[model samples]
Target: MQCPLPRIAVLWSALLFGLALSAGTTPALAQAERCPKLVAGNPFLQRLAPRTVPAAYVAPRQVGLTYIGHSTFLIETAGGVTVATDYNDYVRPAMVPRVATMNRAHSTHYSLNPDPGIEHVLKGWREDRDPVHYDLDIDDLWVGNLQTNIRDWRGDTIRNGNSIFVFRAADLCIAHLGHLHHTLTHDDIGALGRLDVVLAPVDGSYTLDIDGMIEVLKSLEAPVVIPMHYFNESTLENFLTRFAGRDYAIERRESPELVLSRETLPRKPTVIVLPPGG
Candidate 1:
C-alpha cells in the first residue's frame, strides 16, 4: 500500500535522522543546554586535546552542515530545522532554510529580499545600532546571537554592526562569525560561553587580519573551525600557513559538507576546510 504524504515525509525525516546518527552526527537533544551563564577566563581555552569520533554521522544527535559559498552555511539540525547563515542576495543555498541570519557589514552579507516562506528572518544589525538580540526556540533547536562591531564603507565604526549567531541543538553549540571585523572582547567571549564548532572568516584583509583572527579563534577554543569568506586559494593558503605546526590540525574535506556532533569534536583543536558550494 502507498503511504500517505504526511506519513512518507515523516518516514523520510526519520530515515535521515538514523543515517546521521550512524555517521556520528547524533545530538542529545533533551540534554542540550540553553546558553549557560556568561563567564570569563574559561579553562578550555588554554588546553588542546585530541577527540574521539563516534561510529559515524547520524541524526537526532548529529547535524549536517554544508558550506554554500562565502559565509553562508546550511545548518540542518536533527529536529528537522534548517538555518542559513550570512544569507544574502548574491548567493544562497538551494534548499529553503527554515531560518535565515544576515549581517550587514557588506551588501554580500544580507539579502534585501528573502524568501517569504522562511518562518524566521534574523537581521544582525538594527537601524538604531542597538544590539540585535535573538533567543528563540524553534522545534527542538534554540538559536541566539551576540552583537559585535563592524566597519562601514568609510571605515567608521558601526556599533552592533554584526553578530555571531549561535545554534544550540543536539547537545552542541555552534557559532558562525558573520562579517567579523575585529577581535572578540572579553564580554563577547563570556556571552558565547562554550562553543563546540565555529565558522570563521579567513579573508585576512577584508574580515579580520590573519593574526587577529587567529587570536580570536584561540580565545574561543572551539574544537572545530571551518574557514569561510576567503577570496581565493591564495588567501586560504595564507591563512592555513599561519596555523602551521600550531595546536590546530588541518583537514580538507572532499566536499562542502560535514557531519558533526559533540562527541566527534577532535581532542585537539582542528581546522577543517570545506570548499565553497555554488
Candidate 2:
C-alpha cells in the first residue's frame, strides 16, 4: 500500500499544525500509560476471557452497536447509556441518545436543531472558537476525542475542524472517524491510543481517499474495522474489493448490527461489512 510521498507529507504537516493550535482534548504526549495498547506489547491488550468456554457463552461487559444508515450509529452501553454518532436531522436513532456526537463537514453530518433531551451534545467543530475536546467518564463508558482538520465546501482548509471520537468501555476502545480528511500523523496515532474497533468513512471522495483512509485504518491497528458514510452499494463494494484477500478478512453480514465485547472480537483483523439501515 504505497502512497505518493509528497501528498502524505502535506497531509501529515497540516495535522501537526492543527494539533498545535488546538487546545486541551488529549495531552500532548501519550500518557506513559498506554490504553490497552500494542497487541504484542501488553498482555492486557488481549480481550478478557469469558467465564466459561461454552460456544454460547457471552461476555459480561458488552456494547451493542446498530448501524442507522450513513454515518449514524446507535451505541448502547451496559449501563443504559445510549450514544448517537454523527447525529443529524436526516437520519437519527429511534430514541433520543443520551449522548450525541456531531461533525460539521456537511448538513447531513450535523443538525441545527438537535434534540434538547440529549444529555450531552458533543460538537466536533466550532466556528470562530477553539476546537472542542471532551473527556467524559461516566457510567460504563468513557468518551474522548483527538482534533483534526477538514476541507470546507469551497475546498478551503478549516483548522481543527474535525475530531476522531473515541469511546472506551468494557476494556475496549472504539473510534469514529468523523468526516476525516487526512492521513494521521505519528502524534495523532499516539494520542488516539489502542483502538480495538474503528468506524470509518470509506467514500474515497468526500472524506479521505480510499488509500489514505485505508492507511489511517492500518496505522491505528484496530482489530475490527467497520465502514460507514458510503452512499451506495457499489461504493461499499469498491472499498471491500481492495481488501479482499489482503490484510483483512471481509465479512458481509445480513444484519446491520453488532454486539462488541473484548471477549468477542474476531481473532484476526477483519472488516465487518454491516448493511446500512438497521
Clashes of each: 26, 0
lDDT of 1 by residue, 76-136 (tens): 8765778899988888999778899999887788989999989999998899975456777
User: TM-scores of all models?
Assistant: 0.80, 0.81
RMSD of 1: 13.9
What clash pairs does model 2 have? none
Winning candidate number (lDDT)? 2
- Expressed as tens digits, the lDDT of each residue in 206-264 for candidate 2 is 99999998889889889999999999989998898876776798888899878898888
What value does the lDDT take at residue 257 in candidate 2?
75
Name the Cα RMSD for model 2. Answer: 8.3
